[model samples]
Target: MTEPVKLYVYDLSNGMARQMSRQLTGRQIDGIWHTSVVVFGRETFYGQGISTTLPGRSHHGAPLQVIDLGETAIDEETFNEYVMEMKDHYTADKYHLLEFNCNSFTNDVIGFLTGGSIPDYIKDLPTDFLSTPFGAALRPTIDAMYRRPSPSEPTPPIPSPIPAANATPDSQLAASILQAVAAHTQASNSTPNAATQTLYAPIHAITNPPSFHSFLKSHRAAVAFFTAANCGPCRMIEPVFERLSEEKGVKADGTGAGFAKIDIGVGLGNSLASEWGIRATPTFIFFLDGKKLDEMKGADANELRSQVDLLLFQAYPPHPHTSLSLPAVQALSLNPILFTQVPAIDTVLTRLSSFIDSNPWLSTTQSPGQAKQTLTGTVAPYLKARFSAAPSSKLPSATPTLLTSWSQATSAIASALPVASLFPLVDLWRLALLDPSVGTWVSSFPTSSPILLFIDKATAALKIPDPTSNPRNYLLTVLRLLSNTFATPALARSLFLTTRAALAEVVIPSLLHTDGAVRTAAASLAFNVAAFLQKGRVDKVKGGGGHAARDNTLEDEDWEVEMVSAVVEALGRETTSEEVVHRLAASLAFLLRLSPAYDTQLSPLLDVLQTRAVLKRKLTKGGCGEDGVVKKDVRKLVEEVANKLCP
Candidate 1:
């Protein structure tokens, strides 16, 4: 059932702003607007973080206006999931008086629920306030007021030690890869594909003809299980039918087959059963596109299963790739390589400041006051104060001021400093991308934004004629930033779906970089891209592929060939770092795994590149340098690809 969604608009000034606005700011601002969403018996708002309570129960006593936003078809469970995700983006420290504040949260929620926004006056108040001369004069003072630590705020505890740069993040990466491999293996070994499909809809009970027909009309295929209470065969096969419903029934995306049950005596008082001409107690009638296809009058479980498979086959023809016997590729993990390690925020900021202060051009580009306000005052304070919470508190989202400050800083750095001096700023940007909120904001832009522009500039720097002029720190930091883009899957998908060619330019060359760290980071980025393609292929093979999902897939056929060639070449050259070899091997595995053109493209490409010989040399030469445990792990991963994939 749909729930009524309402907007609760409160005047934060309580009539004072309208009375004194002309005297204070020389602008007649009628109200200081704050808004919250009221839905499902709760009033939700964001301030010192997001809070929800009974309607009309928040600290803001009464709303100045209650706007009916119509009904929301969004269910409670899905809505709650959305709120949890929003928390990561709308943390308390992220609140900005003139930017991201109470009304911003309400606007987001209202959009999620009803696809509508609050009144212009409420949303535009911040922009209006900041535009005035008097308001602009007070902006810094206002920012300082909120940036001040609250007296009641608890002292922050010392953060746990971060892992050394040389240490591999084997625990997190290994666990994820092993888990994916285990699931894929189990699914492949399952008897029927239905056993592995996600369970979404349950076995619906037949009611009146209208409801019954509605169910049939909605699903691609459906089955009506007719039974009587006392029939022995019906009782025996009931559980089997239910199990089938959950596995092969309508999926969450509203596709796939459906299941319904009917009893002659109980359901619709034999109305549906009589209309369908069901005389037998244990009858099964199959449907496709709201019309009866076939029927069977028995409780034979095997026959029922066969009929369900037939229904699905008629609905969605199997992909040709599914017929291949590629056990090695099938068992490969699909988890993308991610760089989630965070450096100390204070240390990062310190290095950034030193870089800025040392350069005369950079130091004087902005006035001392502007420099302090944007960098020292706003940027530094925001990063440090974000972590000044109790140990158990969640990390804060990047504030609107921080985003604005960082963007301005990037623009300033581009003009005042050369490409080589960008390592400090690039390092900070790399760490910032780990924050999912930052990733979300970055992806929301439909065209080239700050982050993308930064990447393009960095990539251009890599292509300069003088190799010695390229700073290794800049290259490694940029590669790491590219890897962290996959930390948020949506951002990763968008990047690949929109800018695969540009990404290929960056990743392909860095794979062959002289520095092992740069090569390792580049391999991780390549692994993420390959993993994304593998996921799309797996989804298509699983029969859940929709037109929209397919649209997000990489359509350029040349990309697969380019990526495969690069990985093969890099793996052959990477003789020292076991980490680089491991990532490159995994990248190759994902690229070749369940590929639609395995016969025509990837298989022939691997053969021509002599990938088997290259991997075999790594195993025989001990090129990863006899680093015992790591060497063994890398060997095992390489062997999985060499023996199973290449052989």
Candidate 2:
């Protein structure tokens, strides 16, 4: 049975309890003077002040009336710990006649237990009291008498110390608040890789098939458990169901499987379960793409868990590729647009003003930066001359010489110019690589190639801080250059044929950065890299991201899969900005194209996208209809990507 949380109103004064309101409202009110809450079924009641209630009636109150708050999901042990936590904060000596009293305590406890809070009318009583003429007249005296007690006044009796050691009340409420926050953090970390948030992810109580079916169609996999309140077997298996809901299986995006429960005893739940032909209590069903994959009945916890686990893996198993080898990849080419020089570089520079000259090196001071003026200046353009002089058709054969020059120029400019100032040089080099001929030239680099060495030097700059410069923006420009260069199937497939672990290592961590632009760039890079690795296999499955729970994974680790997993998790943690959602969505769509199996990995993020306000608004808003398009916000982009992933 659900416990009833009752609010007990009380009268502090004997005869004047009913008459006290005459001063304020000029009307007769009841005996209500003070208040506390009582929770039955837990065999415990709670209130403010240094006192306790033994399950039922309180020593302080007969009561004017009782108002039911709501039920709590907190178990006995956890509730008791919270009770003690509240008691320590509500020490009698700390209670003020107006400020820190029973009402404030009640609001805090009720809010913590359930997300619900006590009525605002009850909470506003103190402020209302102080606003009256009688209250104003007596307030100073009341303060002197009750607020910490004057030196000569008698003190309230202190409660006996708790039996536990280190039981001193935190002097500051902020300390208790901090402890509460830490406890929440500890709880979230307790269930590793599981969607153990207080708010369940992808878990809904469905009442009808049309609604449920729509959700099923949108996601890669879903697990529904048919249960009833009165069924003992259902009760027994509920823990197992909840555990699986929390455990992650496929990748580290904080999703195990789509989890939901429907009680057949309830009105809507009954029809839905009956429609599915579920006649037993605790019937567990696994679904993929709106089709039933497996089901389990009775209270056999192990079998139920195993079945779901199996489906989770089978639905989206890892197909790791140590190296990519695809004929389509080898036959790839680049767009003609990349070969065209950006004519707006000087315009952008002129707009940036004197800041560039003032801070020659945006983020790095390791180099002298004299070469920046020469490179950015119009008089002596070393890079432009060489790039223009070299024929675009002969680029494949000519790249080594260009690479040698690029390496020296990069080193010289890196030391002499701000990281931001290298945009022109990096930009033109990217444009040069757009020539279809470079595919042969790029793949020709040996492990001993100096070009690989320059890659390391460039990567180190990723970690450098540039407060004035938009590092993410600059990195975005660089990443686009790299992704475009490898957009061709042949060049992307080169990952499998060679050892380029250095580039992958640097790229993966960038996906986890807090900057939306950086993450967007990183995600774009992942999509480009993923195209090189899928090897033409596409399947769907579900997973959560963590070190454990390796399901159906073979010997060859899919480094691309792991990187995508990190992206899924990062998207879950991201809280700010719309642009990130745009880039992240773009990345997800690309990953989906890379492999249909990522639907399992990308599915749980939908829950996050729906719940978080920053991301949610992107999905919910729009004057446009169901068929209408949304703005180019991150969440909107994510929705588009979701369609691509599941479709």
Candidate 3:
């Protein structure tokens, strides 16, 4: 009744169709079939029929047709035309047929059918071959072929989609995705692996009225956080996060796993948050590219630090390029003290005793016990050697007491242990310097040690009375060190004015320093110098007695004049902050009062003040009120200087 379908079968040599015939028997498989020509050397054969074996059918069941177009030398175009002829002849039956061993034929049949190759494979054929008439018919069947359960394999159950009602929040979703990605990246060992593949996909939001996807494309490594404006935890940890980013050498622009903040409370932000399923506030999402790597919640600084470090190590191991070492303090050379014979114990003791006599804080007396025993046992031998030699012969009874105290103190110091020994040495030095009786002992100490140099200079600059002798030489030595030491300009400026010669050497150098702190300090020291010169002059006019007073009253005033001019020049040349300018202006005013004879030089100072006023005006226009105070101060100083000079 269905116009009994005519069966036309084609097969090549080696029985490819014959084999397929055995595979497709008994399943109502009524059709015309064509099979590929298998090529060996140069032989050729036409089609032939073979028996079919279909599912749930026996060997005696009705057999379907199979054809084998055996070994041929036909060109690709000829083979394609032959297949077409078969398709045209059997079009009416709407054939259900299986093609086998078609591997030798070029996919040109599809090209002829569609005038071009198809873009995708409908069945096992390459995409370019899928557009042929035969290919179109086979499309649905081929799709089913892939999904068909194999005789030897069990089928897996399909998963259902997530329900809308139980859908995750956008924030939570984003966090989850990030966490999953991070875990995958950390665990992945292959190049085109799961993590890299995932990174290639576009990230989607999980919320209603879905937001546009926001892709992360950083040139350097980075971790991005999508957050709300009012997130308290985010705010609290911002500084720490920034510091950690810097420590890891990550750029602010997301290089090397840097940090970037996104406010997700706005239009696009809300959409993205919804899409990412961010359920909680202050959730942090880590990403390597478009793919999320990890996520974190809550605001624990320590936990965040640990997580960041872990992730960084995973992404970039601590290889040669990423390794870091702590900076070391530079070393300095020290002078070697000369020792006389293999210095005997008594001689060393005597020298140490003399040192102690000059500096009394290092006492020999101690209570006996484990503590004292430990202390003496550790320090006694060294002390004995250090003070082993006597000063050939002693001078007077008074000298002996001083020498004895020095020796005992030195012995106590050299023999003492740890902080115990060091503390007493420092205490003794401080006491000796502060005391009028034995202050001369300080002169015997070397200024090579930075700590000792600082003390010596500070004492000299503070001008503690003269039983200590003039600290001029100590100050000079300290100045040399300041100029040469790698100490910061701030430290150098602190000790700039220990003496007249020290001031002369340090003031100019500090003023020219590139650092702002050094420049400001230099300016302050200049003011101090001006004050000192003025004070000396005033004292001289009032008949204070001293060779320094009698010899250079005018010279002191000239120095003040010159120093004030230098301050003015510096103000104009240096790029100082507003606060620094104000301070310098105030100092200039003080100098003006101190040296009124140099009234003409007040003009340049006034000009500097005016420049400061202009800067203040600009700042005010920009709504910076704090800087206004500095401007006002400078202006007042200017007015005062002008008034004093004119009056």
Candidate 4:
């Protein structure tokens, strides 16, 4: 009936031809007739049963002609001539040329004979041909051949060379593909109408239910309620959920597309809950067309009402008349107490002094709220106004009068300094520090009894020998203030010269005081001053020249060397009291370790240590011998200093 389709297959290598043949046979083909060209002369043809792998059988039905150009072999011109002669003699459509390693020359022949159109029987090769391992090796040549233009026209200029197989696709191309897929998916889905809907579809329920496909078809938009029966908050929100559905005219019986609950009880699985990323009980999800729109969790009543109103507006836009403008409140009414004027300077100072005297705790403690109430509320407002309005020109002239009054008030407060009064005094000090005029008054105060004495006592309390009694927190605050003073060079230098001289005159001589805390505080203060000097904040005393000779030498360095020598000398004299010797040794060792420049300074100290034979001899006199506490403590401190400084 119909002649079997003569499939014109060409340029297929041995492996690809076999694969194509197998695929064709699987389609239940009847017979295959093969033709091969030996030359352009005597003809040969093959039957279906004959072997085509052999040389003679290869061209069984084709012509035998001896056409050889050279070892370099058939160029395009020669090939085209051979093809033209064959087409003139035989039906070109019935014969196909199976050439090996064909290039643009092969395409030229095909195009010339077929009018530049590929024959119906000549199917394109599989796309994976150049991707295979063996094909990959020859892919460049193969691609060149496929891309070659017809011989009639100059080979279309070779476009920019493609990158190698290892190269990845451009990022924009990948993103474009993804965006196209997303757009296609969105276009295929139905849009949800929020107007007539009661509740939004449950995101988790719809995504997880067995009948999810049917549910999505029936209800376009619904609300998903994620809750656990055991959660107290979830139980509390049940009434709110019910009311929201009723307001929207939704059936409470869960018949229509309304409120749907996903119970995450102990026995029930929560795979769906996790899929929707629900972290807490009473989480609500709004959905449209099987996609999540918005979510809310653990909302209070007012917050829930606002959310409901927002959702309703989105579902049903309001009429023009119903949308009324409301003016916003910008300022709150002020309380008369807060509005009261600042008190007179003298009265404020007097109240501060009186509060401090009545409550000893005011000297250190601070509570801004309590201080504000006491000063601004209890103190007469009229007197405060008078002092605030006083001319700046009169302030200097009035200083002595103000100071005398302050001194009298402070003495009165100090006489009855109770624990409750400390906070008020601290507030007064803060206010004084803030006000330039008051700060000047404090700086010039003649009596050191109240300010400096209180500082010394407080520092002593902080350094108590018993850990339980030590005011560690208060000491930390004092240290912070000391650090602040040293933050600026001018302040640090002034403080160093003043405090250093003070320590040398008053603090150092009192080391053997009755209280352990007093001795410790003195030592600690000395150590801090030394540390500050070591940091290069203070200038040394000068001679005839304006510049000091010891300007470049660090204060801590000189202090450490001097103190170490003093301790060694004290230990050697054997005349100094045991307590003094002990204290000196302890303080020297502590300074040696704490000083950053210990290694640079240690050699001189060690030399002194070696020259003093009495100290070394005393070390051997003890029962514990060389490893006793005194020798051990000194040796350990020296060893640590050596490691850190040497390293």
Number of the top candidate by TM-score?
1
- Give per-model TM-scores: 0.52, 0.33, 0.23, 0.23
The sequence of per-residue lDDT tens digits that candidate 4 reaches over residues 48-120 is 1111133343422122222221121334454445444433223211111111111112222332222222221
Q: lDDT of each model, Cα atoms only?
A: 0.69, 0.50, 0.37, 0.37
What is the overall TM-score of model 2 with all chains considered together?
Answer: 0.33
Deviation from native of the Cα of residue 447 in model 3, angstroms = 12
User: Which candidate, 1 or 2, has the higher TM-score?
Assistant: 1
lDDT-superior candidate, 1 or 2 = 1
Error of 1 at 389 (Å): 9.6
What local lDDT does model 3 show for residue 480? Answer: 32
TM-score of 4: 0.23
Model 2 residue runs over 4 Å out of place are 1-399, 411-421, 446-455, 464-474, 495-520, 534-558, 569-583, 590-618, 622-647
RMSD of 1: 27.0
List candidate 4 segments past 4 Å from native.
1-412, 418-450, 459-495, 501-647
Error of 3 at 34 (Å): 99
Candidate 2 RMSD computed on C-alpha atoms after optimal superposition onto the true structure: 20.9
User: What's the true lDDT of residue 559 in model 2?
Assistant: 50
Residue 404 lDDT in candidate 3: 43
RMSD, every candidate, angstroms: 27.0, 20.9, 29.4, 30.3
TM-score of 1: 0.52
Superior by TM-score: candidate 2 or candidate 3: 2
Ranking by lDDT: 1, 2, 4, 3
* Model 1 spans with C-alpha error above 4 angstroms: 1-333, 360-372, 385-392, 446-449, 543-549, 626-633
